[model samples]
Target: MPEFTRRDIARGVALLGTMATLGDGSPLFAEALDAKTKAALALVNPELLSIARKEAAWRNGPPLTKNYLNIRKQIDGSVAPPLPDIPFAKHSIPVGKGIPDVIIYVINAGGTKRPAILHTHGGGFVLGSARSEIRPKQEMAKALDCTIVTVDYALAPEATYRVSVEQNYAALKWLYDHAATLGVDRKRIAVMGESAGGGHAALLAIVARDRGEVPVMFQCLIYPMLDDRTGSTRMPPPGIGVIGWDVPANVFGWRSFLGQQPGTATVPVTAVPARTKSLAGLPPAFIGVGSIDLFVDEDITYAKRLIDDAVATELHIVPGAFHGFDGAGADTSIAKQFTHAKMNALRRAFGEQSV
Candidate 1:
């Protein structure tokens, strides 16, 4: 039920009837489905979307803002290097025969086989690298003084969907099989990813659980790209012309990664975690997404579903912000609120809530 009033339904029928992807998806989807989710949503909410355009005005500041706000490159300068007077060793492990480009950054967290975080970076599964996550992972290492193995998995338009997910599974499997060598506890290992990587984390968590090998302590999914359907009313509202990410890019990302247009008959949950049914006996979870973000509704709905399935789940929806808001470097109060909330969520799940 979409809270759709009769008036909304009439309006939606008019809007969706004439909906077009011309003002939408490209470069990725050559195929079109006769779906108009955006139209239906507008009718249901009857609210206008206001995107702050003036924020992009030429600042003449440093070429890049120093706030460490690139979600792919978001980092704080005060972040110290790999925890307590201990030295961390870096290594490359096998993740699908050198396909995922998996790399590891390790440091002594100064405790018995400590809890570890298998961190994955997000770039719509096309643009981020393990290097981009270093600053945050370093900051996290300092915060909890725990072992973290940052993954550099393959991207889309090249490797596509399922490849990244399979790589994620491989990395986790290796960690579980050799937890002692990695200096982490197998039972306490958790999966963490942002955006597309977050989707990958969620999907891989399901994969690992189904395989019945490694047990995940928790999953930190930050504004994860979970859904596979492209044209549903779940897209960014039309009036909000925020670039960087939108319907076109989403379709392209899916086509490139899945090797087919999204919403196709063969699309799999391994490629889109939102399509999955079974959500039980996996792990405690922390999920966060901004209200206007493309994934907001899906994220909130997924959180509710997890709770419905008797899973321990904590979800926060940061209103007044859109997708990747925390990394956008906007001075809006909402961005900071979400950033702090996200950090707090990570801290709580990692057993470092005091920080």
Candidate 2:
């Protein structure tokens, strides 16, 4: 665990204070959203809104000020508590060439050969870890009676573009290769991720198709950060950037992951799922995003492409929600609906009769 200084603690306290002031379902703040979006924002989750407010404050400054390490520590601290006390086993898989071994969190699912999910944590690609964001995975494991493996893929600046993708791919392959030992059903494996993890999950599906080794039955992308062009070459819809992962933070995350300025000519298609010309032959997908989220346009666009390619896809756009709302309002009615929809999609993809 990383050590937090007084300043870090104060910043976190200030964030809580700011969130407290926002109150639950503030009508004043709801006006920033569009009419269609406002309906969903009627009962805004204060906890999620707080995260948006913090991001908004960060957006007001130089994006680089939000260091990956610091943000990771703070987010981990916030989520570490309230996480379900689910039993999870950790394992390390070797991915040669001196790169760090991939760390996987295998949640307890009793002693059965059940469907498995290879989860990729969000954080724009530079932040997040399996340990920091284990709640959702825990919930999914218990709800669906499945084993969940969340990957701690290498972060960016240090591990650029292909490294994280290949590492996650390797994790998928390892999970498949050792299915019996891990108590996983090889044919029922799926790739799931949130935010940057969603982008990685999308990439992993592409990689799986290309490699023709491990088969991914489905992909559950929760408001994926798919396009590098987003927040750079592409400007989001009007008023959408008012809260939750504004452009400045988006630019910084992309720059850090790409190891160069984002939206540049040199970025490889392999690194950006949006840059990929084809969405054919990929697995079925479930994509959920909020209308106010910066990634809404890109997520909708990607879902359209998948549909056009004749893939089975489900796209859920929450009216007034923002990025990370599902986590922020996990206990709220809307958040429960969001989660239920996602779990239902996964259950169907896994060929289960009931959710």
Candidate 3:
């Protein structure tokens, strides 16, 4: 029973350190708040609201650039609750020729060959690592009784889109190749991620489909940052603005990761999944996002595309939630329900009886 205080919530959300980039004079995606959004806000749990109020200040401050990279390290380095006492191992595998080794976190609860998860962490593509994602993966490993592997792919501005995607792709191949040794049932493996990692998971699924080598049974994207145009050209619904990572910060991340400004022709289709024309032949997907979060529109459209392409999809839109709602607002009923819904989706996907 790890109870998160208000400060802890702020720090955890701050680990991404991109969502809090909104300033007063900046343009808003929505002219005014929608009735439903307002209602949702009112229904938010009190603890989350308190945390949001305190975290809001970060949005009004100066632009967060590479100079702010240290913020991520500081927050991640801080003391937090201990991870679950689960059996695990760490590995550094080569991605490909002339590339750096990718670090991976492997957690196994012994019994039988079980389902597996290939996880990616969220940091707007500029921050975070496998270490940053341990807690949630630990929870999933225990809850689903599966082996979980969290990938430490290259970050942006240093490693461009090609490097990151290829590294994860190599990691996926490794998982498939070593499934027997890792005690993972080959067909039961799923790709799971939050925020930026969610987008990476989606990309990994596409690559798996294209290569026809690794078979990804499912994709779990939690409040994923899917579209580069989302931070550049997309206009959100009225009253749905500045809740999670701000536009400038979003653009900064996309630019750094893409190695060019988002929405530009230079950004190839392979670099951004939202730019992909066909969603058919992809794995079953679970896409979740907050209504007021910056990614809501892109996430919804992606889900619809998946459905239209006849890909099995489960989309959860939390009415009054903001970015990282479950992480920042973990103590609330809505957050609990939100988290439970994802776990249920996994249970169903893996053919386990619902809890």
Best by lDDT: 3
Q: Candidate 1 residues 1-355, lDDT tens each?
A: 0122233212211101111112221111213212342332232211122222212111111222121122222222212243445455566777655465556655453467778888777766655666545655766666666777777777666687656776777778877787877667777888888777788888878888888888888898988877867443345555231322446556655676788778777886666777787787778888987555567667887888889888899898765454554554334466566667766766676666644
Which pairs of residues collide in model 2? none
- Candidate 3 lDDT at 68 equals 49
| Candidate 1 lDDT (Cα, 0 to 1) | 0.59
Question: Rank order by TM-score, top first?
Answer: 3, 2, 1
lDDT of 1 at 162: 56
lDDT of each: 0.59, 0.74, 0.77
Clashes of each: 8, 0, 3
Order the candidates by lDDT, highest first. 3, 2, 1
Compare the candidates by TM-score and give the number of the best one: 3
Candidate 2 residue lDDT tens string, 260-286: 888989987888899899999999999
TM-score of 1: 0.72
Candidate 3: clashing residue pairs, number? 3
lDDT tens digits, residue span 1-355, model 3: 1233435533455434643223332211233454544544564445566544444534444456744455555446642543757677788888877788898888873556799999888878887778766666777788788999989899988889889998898888888889888888999989989989999999999999999999999999998888999858776655454655767778888998899889877788998889999999999999988777878899999999999999999999988677787877677888899999999999999999777
Name every residue pair that clashes in candidate 1: 37-232, 37-233, 38-233, 70-74, 88-107, 160-257, 161-257, 293-323
